[model samples]
Each structure stands twice: as structure tokens, then as C-alpha cells.
Target: MNQTIDTILNHRSIRKFKPEPLKQEHLALILDAARSSSTSSYLMAYTMIGVTDPEKKSALASISNQSYIKDNGHFVLFCGDYHRHMLKADEKEKETLAYNVQSTEYFMIATVDATIAAQNMTLAAESLGIGACYIGSIKRDLDLVNDLFQLPEHVVPLFGLALGYPDEQQEIKPKLPKEAVYFENTYKDDEAHMAALDQFDQTIETYYRTRSTNQREDSWTKQMIKTLHNRRNDRLTPFVKEKKFNNR
Candidate 1:
């Protein structure tokens, strides 16, 4: 296989990083690779904002609850930038190009495009020895981010990636059994699948018990339950609609 295909298969998220600064050329090259990722309709609807400011990075780190955002040499926020579509419509004298994205297919398309590009960048960084973590918790504090960044209409920050050289090594996280992930032509809800999942849950609990040692939920199922119960911020949909993404 080609080098790019090999890199794609070997991808992993990096959370720990060395403080050494990434060179400007390396930064440009990785970003160029990210931009090379496919975009739906060739709109190039994704935008990555590089953050070099200490305070802003700190704020992002605090929001993400992932300290690596602060420790990394560089922070890059990927966004689903729908504003360009509006600009094009306005300049082309086309009307009815409303930014009403609520429940629209474009919303999902933009999110997918941005996420794909973000992963491409992560792979690019990793291939060059720079570690990185994709931060998703920023959605929790998008209000703080909207005010801080002055985000325009139809533009939403999807996630951020922290970038630096590895200060610490992390093992490859074990994925679910192939049978657990892959399905036949039709989804099979057989007992074998549930059995595999239960086995995997035990495996996850074992890893967490050894790694965390905290008095809390142990299994993957328990963790999923905890997240479902603890996470109450279901406001993102309304917020996105408010931002004119979904017309509702």
C-alpha cells in the first residue's frame, strides 16, 4: 500500500506532548494535507484556526478539561464554516440562500466534512512525529467560544486538535472486536454479538480498574450509563438552530 494509506490505518489519538515548538513549515504542510481532504460539493466548507496565543489556548484547555490543549506547542480549531456559502450567494445576487440550517442535510454534511479534515490533520501530525488530540468538549462551552471568537452566522467551531512532539508514550487503545463493529449485509442482532459486547465490557473494565484505580463505575456499559445520566447539555440542537443552521 501507499504511504498515505498506511498512515490512515495506523492512526491513534495522542494526548501527551513535549513542549518543543512545531516548525512553521511543518505546520503549513500538515494543514495543507488537511485541506487536501475531500470536501462535499467542493465548497471547502471547513476552516482551521491556528491558536498561538497563550491565554486563548488556556481558555480552550480549561473548557476542554484536557490539559494537553495548554501543554501542546500549537492548538488548531476546526470549524464548519457555512458563512462562505452565504457570502457566495450574496455576491452572486442569489436570494433565498438562507442560513437556516436547522435539521437541514447541509448541517450534517458540513459537520462530516470538518471532522474528516480534522482527522486528516491529526494523521498528518502523527506521521511527522507530532502528537495530537482532537478536543470535542468545546461544544459544552460554545457560548463562551462564540463570544470569545466573535463567530459569524452559520459558522460553528466543531472541535480543536492539540499538537506537539510526544513527551510521553501512550499505548494503542484496543478497539471492539471486528465482529462487534462489522455487520453482515443486514444487521444481525444475534446472541453472539451481545456476548462479544459483554466480553468487551469486561475487557474495558479491566483496563480502567488497572489504569484509574478510582472508586467508580468499572465496565464500558457503566461508563456509557454514567455519560448518559451526567451529560445534560442537550441544548446544542436549539443553539445551532438559533445560529440559523437548522431553520426551526
Candidate 2:
């Protein structure tokens, strides 16, 4: 397989990192990769806030309840930003669509752009033998995080990324097989889908038994049922709406 495919296939979420920082040039190149990602309609609606300061990182770590946010050599928060576009529209004295409300299309596009940038940075880090982890728990306490980061309107903190040299290696998490995920011209019925899902669940259960960290005696289906039964983050809708994304 090609080196790129090898890097992609061997991906793992690294939680432990060495204290040493990444080289300045390497960090720059990684950021360049992030900037090089494709954006929807050329609207680079994402902002990355790299935090190295002890105080700021500590605050973010508290918010995320993940100590790696403070301990990692670098922590970056990727934000979905439309405020910049609005400011640009003002500069041009052109009337632009008011996306202050929950514009689903705009939110989706911005989120996709941010995700692409994040994945690009992650792959670049992996290629350089650096380890990284995506921190989605930042969304759990959005208000505190927003205040800590001083986010303006139309800017949502989608996720945080922590990067450093590896301190530990982890087993790559198994994914659903192609039979379960990939489809032909038409979508399959419940019977076909459930059969594939059952097989995948068995595979995941075996993987969990063998994994080094947080090993659990459970299948994918059971985990999903447990995790999804309660929509714990009811605040998500209100929080996004408070950020002025409130739209139907």
C-alpha cells in the first residue's frame, strides 16, 4: 500500500503525549496542511486557536475535563466562523444573507470545512510521527468554553485538537465493515442492514476485549443503544441557538 494509505489506515487516537514540543517548522507545515484543506465554496469558515499558555490551556482542560488539553504540547480549538465573512461583507458594503439565525445550510458547510481542516492537520501530524487526538467533549460545556475563548457571535467552537510526541501507542479502533457502511445505487432494507450490523458488532466486541485501554465486554450495538438512549446534551440546541444559530 502507498505511504499515505498506510498512515491513514494505522490511525489511532493518542491520549498520552511526551512533554517535548513540536518543532516550529513542523508545526508551521502542519498548520499549512490545515489551511490547505478544501472548503465549501471557498468559504474558509474555520478558525484554529492554538493555545500553549498555561493559564488558557488549564482553563480549557477544566472545561473539557480532559487533562491532555493542558498537558499536550499544543492544543488547538477549531471554530466554525461566520463573523469574519459578515465583516468582509461590511467592508465591501454589500448586503449578505443574515446567517445569524440557525441557517442549517450555512452551519453544515462551515462544520464540514472545519472537519476537513482538522483531518488534514491530523494526517499531517501522523505523517511527521507526531500524535494527536480530537477532543469533542469541549462541546459539553459550551458557555464556559465560549467565554474562556472570548468567542464572538456566529463563531462556534466545534472541537479541540491536542498534539504532541507519542508517550503511548494504542490499538486502532475497528470500524464497521464495507458491507455495513457502503451501499449500491439504492439503500438496502432493514434486514440486510441489521445482518451486516450484527456481524460488525461481533467484530467490535472482540476488538474491545483485546484493546489495551478501557476494555469493555460489550458489542457496538449495545454501546450505541446505551449511549444513544438518552440524548444527554439537550443543551446543545439551546447553546447553538444562543450562539445565534437558531433557525428551523
- The candidate scoring highest on lDDT is 2
Q: Which one wins on TM-score?
A: 2
Candidate 2 local lDDT, 1-248, one digit each (tens): 99899999999999889987888988999999999999988989889998877998888888778888888778889988877777756633433345433588888888999999999999999999999999998888888888888999888999999999989978888888787888899887667788989998989988888777787799998989988997487778888877766465
CA deviation > 4 Å runs, candidate 2: 91-96, 99-101
TM-score of 1: 0.89
Model 1 CA lDDT for position 81: 76
What candidate 1 gets wrong by more than 4 Å, as runs, is 1-10, 91-95, 99-103, 211-217
Alpha-carbon lDDT, every model: 0.78, 0.86
Question: Candidate 2, after superposition: displacement of residue 94 in Å?
Answer: 7.2
